[model samples]
Target: MPVDIPGPASSVSVQHEPFDVGAEIAAIAAGRPAIGAVASFVGLVRELPGCPGGLSAMTLEHYPGMTDKALEDIVGQARGRWQLQDVRVIHRVGRLAPGDAIVLVVVAAAHRGEAFAACEFIMDYLKTRAPFWKKEETRDGGHWVDARDADDAAAARWDV
Candidate 1:
């Protein structure tokens, strides 16, 4: 299912190859006169202790139907809360190296504040609400990365 706003153009895809942040930002702003500012964020895998040597690779998994719906809901909330021109979110799944890009978020608006706030809001919501799970491969073995309670707290701050 496609997740996009009703009036503005948006693109969301799951890809294995590394995403070009510059290109995606350009695409979001191209030919869009209403968009005066674009905000973006890219998350990368990091090496963390606790599992043998460190994280060598990570795999992301999601429940097919629920994942898309959750992402759409997040985008919808951003639209309702801000005057955004467009939004895009792309998350990668499968084996990824330590430096690989995990997800990308972009928001466009007529002003910088709305674009920035909405972009951060979507990212915070995704960290907690998205149905995706991460499994890290360390020197010892593989284990599912537990979601932190702090992430949930961060998302809750936006709620009225």
Candidate 2:
């Protein structure tokens, strides 16, 4: 059974298709007059170094239930920290080429501070905590990517 999340305050989806940032923003901002600020972050796939033949594509894989729960938990944490009006997270799976959109996080709040902080918080947690495995493809072949020190440091600042 699907869980019932009351109100239009939050949404999280994992799909293979691309999402329209403009449409997503409009949908979340609609009918919400109190929202004075909206902040968003879009992650894109780029060519990584050390690929002998250069990068061609990347594949993302995740377990259905686990991935959803992890994302929801991250969003819940962000909501607890900030007074947000709305939040949306969309993550793409399957094979994606260079320059493809990987993930989108949108946060709305009455103040720019809350919106910006919440947006970054959600992204930081998502990057480290989400259970997604990535394999980068090059002309030579594909290799499973590993977690980076920079990403860990980004998520560590939220520790209290």
- Best of the candidates, TM-score: 2
Model 1 / residue 139 / CA error / Å: 0.5
List the candidate 2 regions with Cα displacement exceeding 4 Å: 1-10
Instruction: Give each model's clash number.
Output: 0, 0
Clashing pairs in 1: none
Best by lDDT: 2
lDDT of 1 by residue, 22-56 (tens): 98899789999999999999999987855557888
Model 1 ranges off by over 4 Å: 1-10, 49-52
In the range 46-130, model 2's lDDT, one tens digit per residue, is 8877666988999998877888889999999998999998899989988999999999999999999999999999998998998
- Worst 10-residue lDDT window for candidate 1 reads 1-10
C-alpha lDDT of all candidate models, in order: 0.84, 0.88
